[model samples]
Target: MSEIVLRNVCKEYEKGNFAVKDFSLDIHDQEFIIFVGPSGCGKSTTLRMIAGLEDISDGELWIDDQLCNYFDPKDRGLSMVFQNYALYPNMTVYGNLAFALKVRKASKSEIDEKVHKVARILEIEHLLDRKPAALSGGQKQRVAIGSAIIRRPKAFLMDEPLSNLDAKLRAQMRIELAKLHKELETTIIYVTHDQTEAMTLGTRIVVMKDGVVQQVETPIELYNHPVNLFVAGFIGSPSMNFFQAHVTEENGRMVVFIGNPKDGKKIYLEGRRSELARLRAMDQDVTLGIRPEDIHEYADAAELGIEKATVGMNVTVTAREMLGAEVFLYFDEQKKTHAVRLHPKNQTMTGEKIDLYFDPKKIHLFDQNTEESIFYREETV
Candidate 1:
């Protein structure tokens, strides 16, 4: 049961600047955790702290029942897979896998057995005799993983292991990596900047920004209920769209004022009592957030139980991207590039004006001052 507990961990360097601030979490045994964010977000720094490669300036690092803040990386009983293959060019895959074992003084028979077992598990046994240069990128990665797994460490720390691979290969590796986690039953801490990898591979994802942890949650929860504007924008591909708007009570309902007040394109929230109250209580100028898929062509609204909009905006299509499965329509709105996803067969052309509908129930509202989700703050609390 190799659980890890971090209590108010921090990494500070030079003149009180921190690369990781007040970082804390409890990672359970056999869990696949991913640390994700943009460059210089302190995700990799945090992972290095866990691996004992970086100093923790404050707080505690506990692995299992032992304090490991100052423990040597090898003494901490964790192995790491780096982004670079790091295999010796002249060494066969089998030799690279057994090199560490040899350094530890394992007998030849023992080394041979361990290397073959890990090779078989990673499905690279057929290439065991091949040198590093003879293998493809994916094959070399498998060798790197095999080298790490042969020791049977307490946990595996992977630093963007798939970053060097192409798109199609990366997708395949994500699935394999997930399967490996389950089969090994070892705690895994992975770091990457790709949201798709974070969503697909992690059992739990840690979102970070500028040396601070923003949120940690299951993939679906993070995607469905982001806590702030940064998360909502960073988690999804193409991201969520934001519109500057003000909220006010109109008659017995709460309405979101979009575009100009003189314009007739506003969303009405009448029967949504709970959401209405949540908005009306703190209602003011807010950024309205919506996903591309949430916007629908008028003909498709009924299938989703969304009623006809009493008022809607005519969006002029400025660009379109076709992916065979669906189409993304881009339009300029209030000086922003807003997008909507529609069925591929829909004949939306560039420079064409079409009425698009926004689903009020799917809309998210953020406080203009704080840029935080009013609904999420209350729910999380």
Candidate 2:
């Protein structure tokens, strides 16, 4: 089993400057772990350090009980699939897949068997005689993966391996990679800025920003519960909508005033949420977080039993996009654009005004100063 443990790992490029700071995680065997963040967030750099491509400036890197901070990349028993495919243009697919085994002086017959087996798994058997230059982006990637698979390394370290492909090809490759992961049953450490890939493929995701890991959780856990504002904002497509709000007790119930309370728009919190807000942030400003899907139209709000006050948000539709299965309506609120996902049958047009309601149970609250989720559970984190 390939269990990797990082304890307070820091990658300092300069004396006082760091690329990764105090990062720690216990990655279990056969787990599809994703390192996701925006550009230059050090997701790739962290993966590189684990692969021994870069020096670990501080802290320990343990692989299955052994300190691997000083191990050579080749000695680390991890195969890396790169963004560019990294296939040898001069070599045929067969040659590329067989190269690693040849270096170890594996028998010719053994090399052939492993090459064909990996080719079949990756579905590149038909393209074996073709060179890298002749293959499509997906085919070339399959060959690159085949080369790695033939080696049978302890784990796979992939750094944006699907970034170069188009949207359609990327979607296809994502499915293929998921299947490959299952068939091989190996641990995968993948780095990508694409949240879609991370959400779809990862068993657990590590969200990083500016070299620091924000949170690590299962895909559903990260989506439903994020520890901080950055993670809540970063993990979703179209992202989570944020609103400036003030929390205060009204008639013994915690109420949040959206934007200017003079507009007569507010949402009431109840039970644990209200209690938590009362104890920690009564009368303080908070950032209300809600997803597009959580904001519903009047009919939906009524059916969902959301109170009338919460459904009182009146917004002018600035833009409307019909995405076949779902429609996205955008509006300007608090000087920032917010989106709402609705049924494609929505007939609301640009310049029209419509009322929207937030699902109170699905609402998230973050402290304005700390930017930490007020509802964050330390046990889950």
Candidate 3:
């Protein structure tokens, strides 16, 4: 296994468009690192640079402590699996897997041994004699992976290898890929635009946007404690709820304004006095962020300090989705649409007005100007 590191790496096209800009990251030995972002983000370009498929305009590329900026792709000791399952249609699965060995003038017996071993590891031994034409989409992908693994490269670069699979098959293959990583124990750098795949498959995820690295962290950490508004908005499934708000002292308490215009509401925050004072002193115009799951149906407003900020408009429930034990309530609130997760037992009506309770401690605050998180610190408990 080998560690891959990129320091101040950059990729620029002739059009003066920078695909990747001063990118720097270290992929530890045997670590599964995923590069994830939206389309047109530099994820694929970054992966291509590591694979030696694209030239690094400026900066260093290191593999196993060796500077490899100019190393040929074959000499990098890495194998890449592309999105399209680049298999030769004329060759059988076994032949495809053994092609590299054959080109290197290995004995037929040696090639056969390597092919069968990889097929067995990938659980595609039964399909060894079948051509790419006869294989299913998932099977073709497995063969592609098998071919990459047979080389025994120090690192694997997978670029959205599962993108073509169906939803059900994608989930199944995700599990299989994770299992394969454990068995092989080789360094892997996967690139994808799918946040779900990045969150589920990667040991660590690097979120990127506009050719710049945003945040890199474990899946749970990224979900719970994103570094900025962009990371917070991009990483979550439902996408975190953001409200433009002002931080002000009200009734001797530091509160965040919802600024609804029609009927503004103030949500009191529960945090250290010092922190609140610091925020106040900075004159920071904060953006209040809350996850849909954090907002609950107000059962007893009196008990939770929930106050009726207004009763201007009743939100009409547009749709309701029952997700087993819980139901997702999609409704229009105060001219803005919002999603709320509620118990399946609570049969809320479509046109009924519901009071939502916001948990102050679970709230996130962001700097309005910088769009950076202001309430992120290592938790004590």
TM-score of each: 0.95, 0.98, 0.91
Off by over 4 Å in 2: 378-381
What would the TM-score be for candidate 3 when compared with the true structure?
Answer: 0.91
lDDT of 2 by residue, 85-126 (tens): 888889999999999999999999999899999998988899
lDDT of 1 at 7: 93
Question: Clashing residue pairs in candidate 2, if any?
Answer: none
Q: What digit string (tens of lDDT, one per residue) describes model 1 on residues 1-381?
A: 699999999999765898899999999999889998889989888889999999899999999989999999989999989999799888998899999999999999999998988888889999988999999899899899999999999999999999999888888888889889888999999998788889988899999999999999999989888988898898987889999887776775677778666786677764543464345434678888889998888787767656454356788999999999999999999899998999998898999998888887777777877877766855544
For residues 1-381, what per-residue lDDT tens digits would candidate 3 score against the true structure? Answer: 598889999999765789999999988998999998889889989999999999999999999999999999999999999999999999999889998888889999999888888888888999988999999999999999998998899999999999999999898899899999999999999987777788888899999999999988888888888888999889877777777766766666666666653355666655573265355423446777778787767663345554443112235677788888988877764356678777788787676666677667667778877877776664322
Candidate numbers, best TM-score first, in rank order? 2, 1, 3
Comparing candidate 2 with candidate 3, which one achieves the higher TM-score?
Answer: 2
Best by lDDT: 2
In candidate 1, stretches whose alpha carbon ends up further than 4 angstroms from where it belongs are 270-283, 377-381
Q: Best TM-score goes to which candidate?
A: 2
Candidates ranked by lDDT: 2, 1, 3
